[model samples]
Target chain A: MIGATRHYEIDIDKVDHMSKQLTEEEKSQIYDDIKEFLSEELDVPADQITPQSKIIDDLNGDSMIYLELVEMFKKRFDVNVEVRLIGQYFQRHPIYTVGETAQAVYDIVERGDNLLADEDKASV
Target chain B: MDQGIELVELSALTAPGVEIALIDIERHPHLEDAADQFLEPDERARFVTLRSPHRRREWLAARVCAKLLAARKGLIAGPHEARIAQDRSGRPALVDPAGRAVTGITDCSLSHKGRFACACLGRPPIARVGIDIETVSPRLRSLRDAFVNPSDAMEFHVDTDADLALLWSLKEAYSKAIGAGLHIGLKNITSNRNPATNSLRVRTLAGRVAHARHVVYSNCVVAVCFIAQ
Candidate 1:
């Protein structure tokens, strides 16, 4: 279950958000929301999810759930990243923990279709 | 729930020459040792890295299910003989003790939901196979729109949550068999039940006419799909 098959065809002004890097405050909110969502999806307690708490090995997260997380951000924040890019990104920057997942979501929201390495982070 | 597996429900989901399993995933407190004996070296490394006690146990239990199915089919001598690894898309795949892909086993898959786990291992003509088991619950009905379209709901007679769960399992089975796993959107896959043949018609991940079937067992919906290469 490391992949998601569901994709939305909605036309959210995702284009408007592209290239708009979120401020640290915005990113912080994104991170907390992701952690909260993970807690609900995995049925795990919120306090148990540490910065190091893994999405799969620890949280029993199926990749499909990760896809849902991506979709969630898309609807809520009008971000757009094809599932393929998400998969391709994970192949190289393999994210296993909640913090990592949050960062990835932050990247998608800011960069949209173009995913860069974490080291390429420009504005922190 | 009886740990004693009566293959009645699972039997419907099984293809010829394929080994299938549906069993309770009990926590084994001695998993560090169990992982040493039950898993491949890399699998063991991954096992120890698991922080969740729940996941560690589920991980071992799934391998045990796969090993038990393979053992019952005489495919391997023992647990240490074969290793369960992920395929290119991260689906569970079978390999030898040395990490070489096992020949003749064209397809295999694993799924865990709630306290139960399921696995399927298919031989030569099977080409590829996928199997899934969902613990029937009202939650699935509530989330039906996430995966179900009107066509599928109508075809499967989606009255109860269990029916929706079976529908979900059928689509999951096809997607996993096709090697897409959960990446293939559940909405795209549809099932039309054929009472005449006691099977569900579907398209495999390979785009061939999928050989698929499903069965219900005590609050569980188990389904499988096989496509010959």
Candidate 2:
């Protein structure tokens, strides 16, 4: 059932940019980890996780899971993504699939430090 | 009153036939142990797999509260005699000792927030019922646009965090009552306030209407919904 539902198109440009920062092997490994995590968290079969599966509609997940996923990305990638920024991003662009979530995690890992610093400065 | 739903305290709803149980998750230091006594084998397995302590506590509290309510309603001999299972849409249903769906015989809904869990039970003919409790917080304001319907946003004026929390809880209660949850988006559920009675008339996009009653306790807003008979 994975990759069965397609609502939004993947940003190939962003994917290409992410590819430069992380190796193809690393990306595949990250995707595998995400699929495993979600499968276990949602109690769904791993085979059902597709790049196009709707996180809420298909996976039976909620906003809290999205926030947790962002935190997981930060810890797994050793980056500093602001929780508030990730929350706002999810609100604006509700993630639907494993692929979209992976892309969002990759983008955050690539620019997390700068974003966290900017958020800190803005607070001051 | 909107649809004749009288707002009352959780305690007030407790009567001979109707059973309501409220559990303070924080007060029970050994809720995990108590919860185990109530959960069936399948429920226990699921409970073991919960990664978050908070989630586990809430799950346990809700199940325990449900079991207590079921016992009080005489649907089961004890907590272990009943099993709570979710349908395809993830709505919890009561299974009798004979392993038959008892939802037709009894109606139950569970809601929890922070350290509080509430379970409300009604007999047959009250097939659809929902209860939700949410802590009053500023976060409700930020998530308002995502859930509050435009019609409700304009008709039901929310001036403070408490008001927003009540509105969100009302929507959640209604959704759970309909057994659709958020599948029926919060924005799809409309609310019309009856200030004179301090209640609201809520309608779902699916054309189901329910009367919601709420009360505030310990910084939390609790709402319950029942389909008009």
TM-score of each predicted structure versus truth: 0.78, 0.63
| Candidate 2, superposed: residue stretches over 4 Å from native | A1-124, B1-9, B12-18, B195-198
Over the stretch A33-117, how does candidate 2's per-residue lDDT look in tens digits? 7788789877879997898876655665645456556656565555654454564454444566779988877667666645344
lDDT of 1 at A116: 58
Per-residue error for A47 in candidate 2, Å, reads: 25
What are the candidates' individual DockQ scores? 0.24, 0.05
Candidate-wise lDDT, in order: 0.71, 0.68
Clashing pairs in 1: A3-B182, A3-B183, A4-B183, A5-B183, A5-B184, A5-B185, A6-B185
True contacts kept of each: 0.25, 0.00
Relative to the unseen true structure, what is the Cα RMSD of model 1? 6.3
- For model 1, the superposed segments whose C-alpha errors exceed 4 Å read A1-17, A41-43, A78-95, A111-124, B1-9, B27-34, B138-146, B157-160, B181-183, B194-196, B204-206
Question: What lDDT tens digits, residue by residue, belong to model 2 across residues B1-229?
Answer: 0112112237643433345667887778677765656778898888876644676787777888877767655677777778888875567877876678664345678887777888877665565778888888775554555566667657666767887888888888887888764445566777787889766778876678886777788999888777634
- Model 1: share of true interface contacts reproduced: 0.25
C-alpha lDDT of residue A24 in model 1: 81
